[model samples]
Target: MKALTTYIISQTKLPEVSVKNTIELLNEDCTIPFISRYRKERTGNLDEVQIGDIVKFKEQFEALEKRKIAILKALEEQGVLTPELKQKIEATLDLTTLEDLYLPYKKSRKTKAETARQHGLEPLAKIIMSQNANDVESIAFKYVKGEIASVEDALEGARHIISEWINERTDIRNNIRQQLERFAMISTKVVKTKADDENAQKFRDYFDWEESLSRIPSHRLLAILRAESEGFIKTKIQIDDDKALDKIESRIIRSNNECSEQIQIAIQDAYKRLLLPSLSNEALQIAKTKADESAISVFAKNLKQLLLGSPLGEKRILAIDPGFRSGCKLVCLDAQGGLLYNETIYPHPPQNDSMGAIKKISSLTEAYKIEAIAIGNGTASRETEAIIRKIHFKNEIQVFVVSEAGASIYSASKIARDEFPNYDVTVRGSVSIGRRLQDPLAELVKIDAKSIGVGQYQHDVDQTKLKKELDVVVESCVNAVGVNINTASASLLSYVSGIGPKLAENMVSYRDENGAFTSRNDIKKVPRLGGKAFEQGAAFLRIKEAKNPLDDSAVHPERYDLVKQMAKDLGKSVQDLIGNAETLKKIDLKKYCTESVGLPTLQDIIKELEKPGLDIREQAKVFTFNQNIKKINDLHEGQLLPGIVNNITNFGCFVDVGIKESGLIHVSNLSDGFVKDVNEHVSLHQQIIVKVLEVDVPRKRIQLKLHT
Candidate 1:
């Protein structure tokens, strides 16, 4: 445990106390968001990302320890647990090193070497390995009894065993692994049968691609792997075979003798029959894992940005899930996102009722006092927006094109069905679009993060790992922007610090039965929500109109007394001090700091007092796309057009330029200067102007350069 802590601290470069405290909290089953937000004092004010790193490194060290234990036990059971070998295993921290040390003793299916050992040719094999024997055939002849018929057969068996021995050497395996890492190239070729297939054309860029494994971009690697998985391409890791053999020979071949020549043969055999194939696959897997992590990181970042996107706040929004033949599904949502009304309108082709649709929108806006209109960016979206634009209501309504990526999926989900059981999918979807405009994080939590479509290679990455990372991101975002306990749905509440799905459902059920929570303490009445859960969650759960003003702020209940004391010392009520920035600034944070509540927490409390329940996200602004350019065909070279950065990748970012086919602003074009990270220049949902560089209509590919 101490070693683990030291390793984590070294890796994270975090204070030892904070790392230890974080590890303890994690061991106590605290969520990352909980520790990051409420336990800031214990963790030295580490944010969610730093806390998450500590958790990740701690888990990795624990996994390594578990592997160590398993390896030790296996070696002990096999009666090969020599003190020196055990010391080596115990001392090594690298998993690959430990595995290599264990490889010789691991039981496996009978191979050529195992068969040779069974033929009582162990002595001959050792003699060749020593590389000190002259006239090795004579030495091999001595072992030509029983299953070994002749000197030639004896030498063959000896070489087989020697090859296995060479394959199992720890130094040999490590050296070869290093070689593969430094010099290997990932090469891909189109499958012969799929060469002319239309489906394979998507991967034609990789048909004869070869690049150093270490230098390949994560997106390209994932694409190649996905193409290979779909049977459109064949991929392999390539290395200089002679160079690899020479490396092994230099390590194993120590002398020039009859046995040295045989040892050379075994080296080649070991590499060909075992090491090359095994290490190639291992290198590829390591590369893939790295690529997955990179891709998942990008996905997580994009998800965070999208989830924390500018919310329109509590507004009466009229949302439309636009369609042509099926008409537009429209829903009116009140300030709290409660569905007030829903209907269908056709202002588009096949069943155009433009006047009726315009009249209906105006009437609904006037009746419901709608402040905003959220139109789904789907089929007939721009047309619907144009129609709505023509409707001159009594009040100016803010119109927005909401990315309806996962609205349909959420609408059809069980949660959606439960939320609007009487309504159909279209109505539910429209409500989602409207609610998203009001609160993206709250509504997005109800849908799977991947389905939200702000990612690259989301489906191709490891699902379990992707979910874990995304869950962390969601939890961070949810806790970052505190949840409204009285109004938050189960899906949104589930992401709150310590609240899981069950606790969320219980809270919702309790809210339903007991009415809106009047105080933070009221949360404890919910079933199965114990003291610890309340402690971890209460600060992040906002109780609007609560008796205690602090209940509506980020300041925890435990610190309510301290704040009250501060107010009392000031000869004022807590409510009087709340949001009083002048009063907050007058309070000496250092004077309030204690052993557990340090300057960081006290400062945070002070900040919270100045702006009670302040949301960190910005307000959603209205963006206009180039109305003249609706399709890819309308785009011409050097044309400047407004676009939204929908997705960002390591290589570049994909921009939605008012078309079905998004344009790629490659990283090189992101800035006039050398650009390393695409995110540094652009982010998900960022509105920017891009100049069309090239367009391939057949491929539906658009090349765009950022309008600097």
Candidate 2:
């Protein structure tokens, strides 16, 4: 544990006390969100990202320790566990060095070296390697007895043994790795047989491409690997061969003799046949892991932003899944997102029933008392929005066009089926659209993070690593915003600090059987919810109708007595002290400090008391698309239009300009000068105006520049 603390501190460049305390909390099975929010003083007020870095390094330290144990046990079994070697292994923190020390002991199939050793050629190998024996032919002829038929055969056998020795030398191996790191080029060439195939056009840009392995971007690397996987291109990694061999020979060949010549042959053979293949693979794997981490980091950031998007709180909605020939599917939802009525309406071409659709929609709005209308931004979304705006409602109603990227996946999911067992997929999809407007975080948690469609090369990256990162992002976002116990679905509840899928399911089932919880204490009655679970999750779960107002706030139940004492000292009731800033200011936070609680925690409590359970996100607003542009063909050079920033990448952002194909706003056009990050100028779902630079109608691509 102490060693882990030291390693984490070095890796994160964090305070030693903070790293030590965080590791202890993690050792106690406390989660990232819990430690970040509840134990602010213990963790020195570290945010989720900093605590996350500690967790990452802690896991790495454990993995390294596990590998060390396995290596030690292997050495013990092989009877090569020297005290000096054990000390060396124990002192090293690097995995590469540790593995290099263990390389010679690795058991392998019968290679040429082992075959030559079995034929009694080791003495001949040593004699030639000594470089003192100038008569190498006589030295080789002395060993031409058992499998050696001639001096030439003896020389080849000795060279094979020398090659293995060269391969195992640590200095030579390290030198090759250094060269590969600095000078290797990753190149790809198109497979001549598949060049003209129609399916190969997607990877045409990668054909005959070459770039430095150390300098290529993560997305480009993933794309090239994908093209290679699809059999459209062949990839290679190489450096200057002459430089590498000269470096190796300078280290091995000391004297200019026939023995030096033999060592030269062995060095060349070791480099090409053994070192290059093995080390090149190791270098590529390192590069791939780096690329995966980069890609996964981008994906995690995008997922966090998308999940925390603005919400239109608790409005009765009428939502439509728009279409042309299939007839739009419409559903009415109450304030709590429960479906009240569902039907089909066609207001576009092939049906051309705008008047009839308007009459039905107006009557439904009056019948259901709908306050807002949510239209899915799918096929015919703009046309449907126009038709709905043409109708005048008796009451004021706002219209919203929500992105329906993963609605179909959610509609066909098992969770959807469980939620709406009596309804078909289209009705379920429409309800999802309505619910998304009410709360994007809640609706998005039900779908897989990867399917939410805000990542770069999500599928091409490591699936296990990507899923783990996205889950952490989701959990962090969920706990950061908090959840309404009565209103939150099982999926949302599952992301709360200690409440996993099973406990969330149990809580929901208990809610269905009983009634709404009235206090924080009532949560303990749920099955499988014990002390630790409550401690980790209770503050993040709100009860709006509880008798104690603090239950509705983020103030934990354990601090209720302290807070009551604070109010008592101020000669006021707890309810009166809540949100009373002047009264809250009168109390000295130092008076409440104890061994377990410090000023950081007290400051957090004071902040929570000031604005209890206040949402950290903004409210969703209505947006309108350009009336003149319907598709790519309608767009031309220098035309200004309104668009929404849909997806962000390292290079630029994609803007939806009321068309099927979104336009690309390259990073160069995002600012007047240098643009370090695309998110600094644009965010996910940001409404902005752009000027069209060019349009390729046949290819369905639009290039735009930021209007600002």
Candidate 3:
């Protein structure tokens, strides 16, 4: 256990006390958000990302230790547990090196060497490897008995054993591993049958592609692997043959005698038949894992940004799921995103009922007291926006074109069906678009993160890892922006600290059975929400206008007494101290520090008191697209247009310029100089003006550059 703590400390370079305390908290079943947010003193004030690193390295260390124990047991059972070997195995830090150490002892598939050994040819193999005999055939002739009918058979069998010996040499295997890691090239060629297949066109870029395995971009590698998996291409990893062989020959051969020649032959056989294939595949897998991590990191970052997108804050919205022939599905949502009215409007070419649509929209807006209009950025979206803007509304309403990426998926989901039992999929989808404009985090949590459509190669990467990573991002985002307990949906509450789907369901059921929770203490009366859950989650759930003012703040219930004491010392009531910035700044944080509470915790309490339940997110703003450009044909080179960045990838960002096809601003065109990160220039849902660099109508692809 101490070793595990030390290993994590070394890996993360975090403070020794911090890592140890975090591990202790994790073992006590505390969550990352809880430890980082509430237990600041115990964790030395480490943030969520830093504590996440500690957890990651701790798990890795525990896994490696488990494997070490198993290997030691195996060695003891095999009666080969020498003190030196035992010490080496115990000290091994990585799985690959430990496996290499255990390779010779591990039971392997039946091979040429095992057959040679069974035939009593081991002595001959040893004699040939000695490199002392000038005429090895005479020495080999002596073993030509008992299933070895001739000298040639004996020599061949001896060479097979020597090959196995070379294969088992740890040093030689490690050397080959190094060579493969440093110099291997991954090459792919299209399968002849798939060369002309229609489905193969998407992967044409990867066909006949070759690049350094170490330098290939994560997206490109994932694409190549996906193409190979779909049987469109064949891939191989290789290094310089002569360079690798020369190193192996130099390591194994000392003299040019018959015995040396036999040793050389064995070396060749060992390398070509064993080391190259095994190590090359290992290198490929290592590269693939790295690529998966890079891709997943990109995905997780984008998801964080998308979930933290600016919210329009409690507003009645008129939303439209835009279409042409099918007509626009319209839904009016109240401030809390409850659907109040639904209708269909035909304002496009197929049914030009512009006047009727305008009158209906105006009437609905007025009836619902709508504060904003959200139009889905889909087919006929620009035309719908134009029509809406032209409406002579009686109120000042902001119009926004929301990204419709996963709206359909959310609409057809079981959660949606449950939420609106009497509504159709069209109504549900329009509601999603509207609710997203209201609160993206709450609405996005209802859909699977992968389906949100922000990641490249999201589907092709490791599904389990991607899901785990995205879930963490969602949980982090959810806790960062505390939930409104009175109005939060079960989907939104599930991500709160220590409140999973089951408990979230229970809380919602309790809330529904009763009227509403008035205080943090009231949550304790709910079924199955025990002391631990409340401790971990109470600070993140806000009840507006609660009798106890502290219930609406992020200050934990356990700290309520401590804060009350502070207020009493200052001769003021708890409510008086809340949001009293003048008084909060005057209190000395160090005077409140105790054994359990430190300066960090006191400081956080002061911040929370400064503005109780203040939202950390920015407010959403309305964006306007170029009304002249409704399709790709309207785009021209060097045309300046306003656009919103809908998707960000490692390579660049994709901007929705109010067209059917999104435009790509490759990383090179992001700035006049070098561009290290795409987010530095643009973010999801950010409105920016861009200059069109090129447009290919044949391919329906438009290239863009950032407009200063």
Candidate 4:
């Protein structure tokens, strides 16, 4: 118990308040969301992930402590537990090391050790190990009983016992493993099989390559291991066997010539039979596990970057999902993403007349004040853009071809179908593509984030762990953006703090039964959303109209009264005081600060009021460039190209420059200065201008540069 607590303390490095609060909340069976909200002061405002990690680690420690106690009790019952052994076991920090130390006392498989013990040759084995045997044959012959009739038989039986003794020494094995791991090289070669001896189709590139164990990249190691497992390659590591034997003899066996030779053979035999299999498998597993960890980390990082990518804010947009067979499905939405009009037009079809498409565009733009057109970049997307560009309207509206990677997924989803029951799937997809440009957070929540395609090695990583981590990232992003209570569907609302499927359904039902909720107070009237749920969720829920003006602001409704009092103290109405530049310029927030409203809290309130729920979406910057580049070969070195960052990986960022392919800006070319993490340099969907550095059309590779 003491060791468990110490490990937790050492590993977390969490403040005392956080440690105590996490333990207490975990003890109370409170969920991560509940603790993050209701017990913020106790946990020092630890976020959900930190709380979850602490809980998981603490649970592991408790389980290990229970197992440790059980092991001690079992050994005591067996009457073989010495005080020194007990103390050593208690002091062991890692469970793996402790179990290795106790391997001799644990149950054994049907092995040479058990067979030798049955033949009563263990005493002779120990005597030989003592190395006082001036005559080695004479010493072993003494243990020759009925079963062990000859010196050769007795010696053979004794070797088995000695090998077990060597294998049981945890300290020796641990040392040898460390040495081999550092000194060995993993070599992989294509298998020379009768099926395809010279061809080596699967492992052609890796037919002859060797990497030092310590220097091998995780991905490369996994690739080789997988290739070998599939029978496409042969892989093995070469170690200094003589060095290993010498080390084992120095540590365990006595320094006598005859005993040393026998012990060396025994150690070598044990290594081949026991240690090699265990250590090699362990090394490979470690390599694979590290690779998986790296893959998971990259995926999680990419997911977070994608989920939190800047939204485009609210804007009047005309969305069009282009198709050759079905024609084009057009949907118009206002600044708030409420569907205003929907229709289908065949611009490039049997009719082939531009008049029909022009008339539809002009009517929609005039009727809905369409400021921009978000066309899906699918089949006929460019052709659709060309048709729209020729049309004449009152205002000059910009046209953008959206990625539309997961638009169909969102359109076919249950949430999308629920939201737009009257519309066809194509119409729904058009609306999704348009709304994604308007507010990515509100629209993207309907689709699985994985389908959005901003992950690295996602398919190969642990799917369960990857899903859990990505789901958490999605939830954090959703809550951080703050969903619109009225327009948000149940799927979106479920991501809100303290709201799940049932409560979200109840909320939608209540909203439907009773019009849009105008204030945070109305949430309590929803069925099953009691006081505790309200207390946890009310802060994040915003209302356009409320008695207390701060409710419309990001300032939680719980702090509404205090903000109102401060406004009143300054002889100003709460509404006029918050966003009013003239009044806000005159009033200093420091004058109204109290014990509850520290400098941090006061500054946050001031900032919140300055821009209440300020959307972090970047305004789309329109660029007009020459449509001259069609193929990769038409590019020249140092040619400036406008592109959008499609994805960012550890090595580089992929930029889509309106071509058939994407170009890579290696980590080296990201900037003139050294870069550690890619996100710090570039993020998802960021429109950047880069210069082409190299292009290999045969390999379909393009190297780009962001630096001038």
Candidate 3: misplaced stretches above 4 Å?
142-150
Ten-residue region with minimum lDDT total, candidate 4: 194-203
Write one digit per residue (lDDT tens) for candidate 3, span 1-708.
Answer: 699888997899999889989999999888899999989988889999999899888888988989989988999999998999989998988899899888888977998999999998999888888788878888888888889999999888998999888888888888988888788899999999989999999899888899999999888999999999999999999999888889988987888899988888888888899889888999989999999999999889889999999999899999999999999999999999999999999988777999999999999999989999999988888889989989988999999889898999999999999999999999999999999999999999999999999989998888998998899999999999999898999999999998899889888999999979999988888799999899899999999999989999899999999999899889898999898999878787788899999988888898999899888889998777878897899999989999988888889999999888999999998999988888898888788899999999987889999898
lDDT of 1 by residue, 531-571 (tens): 98998899999988888999999998999999988998888
lDDT of 4 by residue, 1-708 (tens): 345446666777877657776787677555576566445667777877788778767876776677779888888888989999998888776776777767788865789878888999888788778776667888877877788889988877888888888887887788777876788778877666723754445456677888887778655666676667667888887677778777777787657577777777788887777776677667666666777777666666776666665556677999999877678889999988889999888887665756888898899898999999988877777678778878877898888878787888988888888888988778888998898777677777778877887755566566776777677777777766677788787877887777877999999999999999978888999998887667667766776656666666667666678678777877877887767766666767678666545555566667787788666545666643336676688787989988888877667889887766789999899988998888888888787889999998876889999954
TM-score of each prediction: 0.97, 0.97, 0.96, 0.84
What lDDT does the true structure give each of the candidates? 0.90, 0.91, 0.91, 0.76
How accurate locally is residue 347 in candidate 2, as Cα lDDT from 0 to 100?
Answer: 81
Of candidates 4 and 1, the better by lDDT:
1
lDDT of 2 by residue, 1-708 (tens): 889888988889999888989988988889999898889889888998999999888888888899999999999999999999899889889899999888888888989999988889999899888888897988889889977899989999999999999899889999999999998999999999999988888789999999999999887888899888899999999999999999998887878899999889988899999999999988888898999998888788788888889999999999999999999999999999999999998788898999889999999999999999999999999899889988989999999999997899999999999999999999999999999999999999999999989978888888998999999999999988999999899999999989999999999999999988888898999999999999999999999968998998888888999999999999999998889999899999999999888998888889999999999888999899988787788999999999999998887889998888999998888989999888889989999999999998876778899998
Model 4 residue 316 CA deviation in Å: 4.1
Q: Positional deviation of 34 in candidate 3, in angstroms?
A: 1.3
